[model samples]
Target: MSLSAATLRSLKHHNYRLWAGADLVSVTGTWMQVLGVNWLILSKTGSAASVGLSLVLQALPTLLLGLWGGALADRLPSRPVVLATQVAHAVLAAVLASVAMSDPASMTPVYGLVLASGVVSAIGGPALGRFGAEVVPREDLPNALALGSVINSGGRILGMSLAGMLLPFTGAGGLFLLNAVSFFAVIASILAMRASEMHRLVHAGENSGSVRAGLAYVLRTPRLLVLLALALVLGSLGRNYQVTMAAMSAGPLDAGAGGYGLLSTVFAIGTVAGGVIAAGRPRLTIGLLLGAALLTSVAQSVSGLMPGMAAFAALILPIAAGAVIIDTTVGTRVQLDSPGDMRGRVIAVQGVVSAAAGAVGGPLLGWLCDELGPRLTLEAAGAATVAATLVAAAALARLSNVRLDRAVLLPVRGILRRAPAEQAAALP
Candidate 1:
């Protein structure tokens, strides 16, 4: 298939274009703020562990309220839910900026504001995800998801790169204020969308399923259970490159902030390329997901052993690329596999998997980087991801006789592999 055609199929819609364009701008700023938050703690405490703790605090809200947020998204329209959350985010960011400006030396304001923003994000994240699905038809949904990854990764590239450059000039407070301003673009896009064109999902009633129902939904679906397992393991262990990368840049590479930004940009580039390839897939398969995971896990494991900064950056490209495949496959599969009424809840479940990863993995990994060194930390993460992939593949093979062992051994089998129509039904 022509990659351009497949990628553009969804972009042809005017509403998506408007929403996506504005989203690009807003997402870029959000990343800037993310780097800002992490950098601020590093500058103040000079501890990677503190940076990890901030990540935990950000994810903690999702553990507490993310499911409820997804339930609310299912019950209400995504636009208003998203709009309300965006406004909340803007207010919190502005407050952080103000506090940062007044008390540049204080740690209290940073933690407080981060926790507050996390609370809003818990609600907004699912609603925002569901909004992307609503803008395109069922056929275009996969493409939109892949393209969204591209946009998100692109934002990381621009945001982090710019943050590295601007941190010296504007500081963390400036990033917060800019993120606050960026929300207006998304708000305007929401207001501008033609509601008549949206393919909104039909609900059973004003109220659909609860958080418990969402958990039950995933528990019952074997595919989702397997995919969520992958997400938790890979997302938690394999993907906290930020901490290791920062440490590597500062310690081994001796490249400092500028070097860290360069590494991030390259990683984002890999995701963009991977998203494009994933966008071209007409249908996704467990074979593809497992294959992608294994491939990336291997890259990650090898990355830890690289001798120098140059080789390290090159190896990370493939690792980051494979991450996009795993991410897109899991996200697209979970969304399409579930019924419309269950969409929001399912998305929320994915969030739970992510939160669990950060809540547990972030601090653990950060501390390891301090004690064990960045190299060993990356190697350990890679080994865990590899173990998770093989375990998930084996589970499917035992239950469905799907023969994924061959898929894991032969990298090329993944591209050629197609799943059984019913995914060998009766998986628990």
Candidate 2:
């Protein structure tokens, strides 16, 4: 098969096609809502801190409920659970639109709606995370997830672009209204799916459904424990580029908002490109995951050393690409290795990682940027990620005898070569 064919093989399954297409629409609208809400907060309060707080409110639910959310994914039927969440999302969007339109002065209702939406996300995210197993076979899952990264990257670009163009005329309320409509796409798609065609995921047993059990599972599994540590470190330090990017624009680069926006656009392009390339991979391995992790962390360090804005922008492409590949690779490995009963909870830990990044890393990184400046701050983040990756490599080496070259380089070589689907290199 051609590379395009391989990348899109998951879409040949009827259910996944509908789900993915709808997800693209919903994701686009979700980004619009995000930009709209942030704009609304800033316009109302004229304080960047207030805007930051709004983000915290949106992510807080995941920290509080992520484990339970994953447990719910294991216990409940995805059709009903996903359907209900989509509808709740629609309602929340509509309410946000209403509040933005009717009472622009009241920040309380806006904050409340954001928190409620976060609650729904925290609960639904894990089910959504592992939903691909039901739609596509295990063999095609890696492609499905890589394609999802594409959808996400594309959606952010499209949604933010649309919101930027429409916001002046429609206001934040308009973007929210648009997002409200977008949810229907996913809801209808879910209802239309043929449940009979869905595959059963690998289940550990009835006794393995609790949140505590999920945590215990990760704690006991060497590969999983290493991955969890990698996620926390990489996610917190390596992935918080938004703050670092802005600081570079305003501080040493002195390029202002336009430069920040340009860098963001470039990063999005990189992710889209990376996701497309990653979609053609035949399998996910511990090797590919660690390689991508190393590439990302190391590239991050090199990017910090770039003296000019142009050089930095160029470097961010691989940084973003590596980040997406790492995400797709890690999520795929986690899902493949985990039993169905434990899958949601394991995936839900990713949410906890994200929340911790936002709560702990965001503030800490921000302080670093303020005190030490963006250049030094980026180096610190890069150093932190490099150290974490090395420690993880050492742990894996001890547990599984993972060799650096075989585990890291071979898979990356396969990726670069786009090895024939049947001939793709599979490494430890």
The prediction achieving the highest TM-score against the true structure is 2
Tens-place lDDT per residue, model 1, 1-428, is 47578667788998899888988999999999999999888988999778877877888899888888888878788888899988998999899888777757768778888998888988888888888898999888878888888888888788878988998999889999999999999999888988899999865365346777777877988877988988899998877787778989998778899999889878888899888877777655566777788878878888888888899999889788888878897898889888988888888889888888866776688889899988888888888888999998888666676566454554335443533212412222
Model 2 bad stretches (over 4 Å): 202-206, 409-427
What candidate 1 gets wrong by more than 4 Å, as runs, is 39-50, 168-171, 204-208, 246-261, 367-377, 398-401, 405-411, 414-428
Relative to the unseen true structure, what is the C-alpha lDDT of residue 313 in candidate 2, on a scale of 0 to 100? 98
lDDT by residue (1-428, candidate 2, tens digit) is 88779778899999999989999999999999999999999999999888888888989999999999998888777667788888999999999999999857769899999999999999999887767668888888889999999999999999999999999999999999999999999988888888897886654456878888888988889888888788888888888888899999988888899999999999999999889877977676666667677777878888778888999999899889888988887888788888777888988987788688768877788899999988988887888897887787767766776565555556556555755433333334
At residue 198, candidate 2 shows an lDDT of: 87
CA shift of 200, model 1, Å: 0.9
TM per model? 0.88, 0.95
Q: lDDT (0-100) at residue 10 of candidate 2?
A: 90
Native-structure RMSD, model 1:
3.6
Q: Give the TM-score of candidate 2.
A: 0.95
